[model samples]
Target: MTDLLEQAVLTARNLPAERQDDLARMMLSYAGYDEPVIDLTPEEEADLIEAQAEMERGEFATDAEVEAVLSKFRP
Candidate 1:
């Protein structure tokens, strides 16, 4: 490992367990590791199904609409 990475690991080793876990997750993400599977709740699953049905019916936002909605969040 590079000196900087070695130093980071050594520093992480001295951190609390939760901080170590957070650092490990950040490192995995930085290394392009796939995230852990997330099981959707029943309500979320229902929402996804409804969204799929809407998509099948061609009921979706247009690009302009999406851009307009996204622009609302920009500073």
Candidate 2:
């Protein structure tokens, strides 16, 4: 391993277990592993289905609407 990566692993080893797990998850995601699948609640599933129907019907937000929402986060 490169010196930088070795140093990072050594530092990670000293972190709390929860932090270590978070780091491991982040590294796995960065390495292109798909996140674990989660079962959605009934309400969430219904919402997703409705969203898909809206997308199929071209009822999604316009580009201007999207930019307007994003602008709220800009400095």
Candidate 3:
């Protein structure tokens, strides 16, 4: 790997495992790998399907729900 990419991977090592997996997934997808970076559990798979259906049905979190979530990380 190039020095810049090596530095990025090293920096990502300090992140939480889930964030690291997300970065790895993006990298692999960009590299055109036709495979999953990680296997989702049955529940996760079902959740994704349900989320897609909700999106197709024009269902989304209300603004209050979004603000409530954002508030958790706000000072």
Q: Relative to the true structure, how large is the alpha-carbon lDDT of every model? A: 0.93, 0.92, 0.93
| Steric clash pairs (candidate 1) | none
TM-score, predicted candidate 2 vs. hidden true structure: 0.50
Tens-digit lDDT string for candidate 3 (1-75)? 999999999999999999999999889897769664677899999999999999999999999999999999999
lDDT of 2 by residue, 1-75 (tens): 999989999999999999999999888887668965567999999999999999999997889999999999999
TM-scores, all candidates, are 0.47, 0.50, 0.49
lDDT of 1 by residue, 24-62 (tens): 988898776877556799999999999999999999899
Clashes per candidate, residues 3 or more apart or on different chains: 0, 0, 0
Off by over 4 Å in 1: 35-75
Comparing 1 and 3 by TM-score, which wins? 3
**Residue 5 miss distance in model 1 (angstroms):** 0.2
- In candidate 3, clashing pairs total 0
Better of 1 and 2 by lDDT: 1
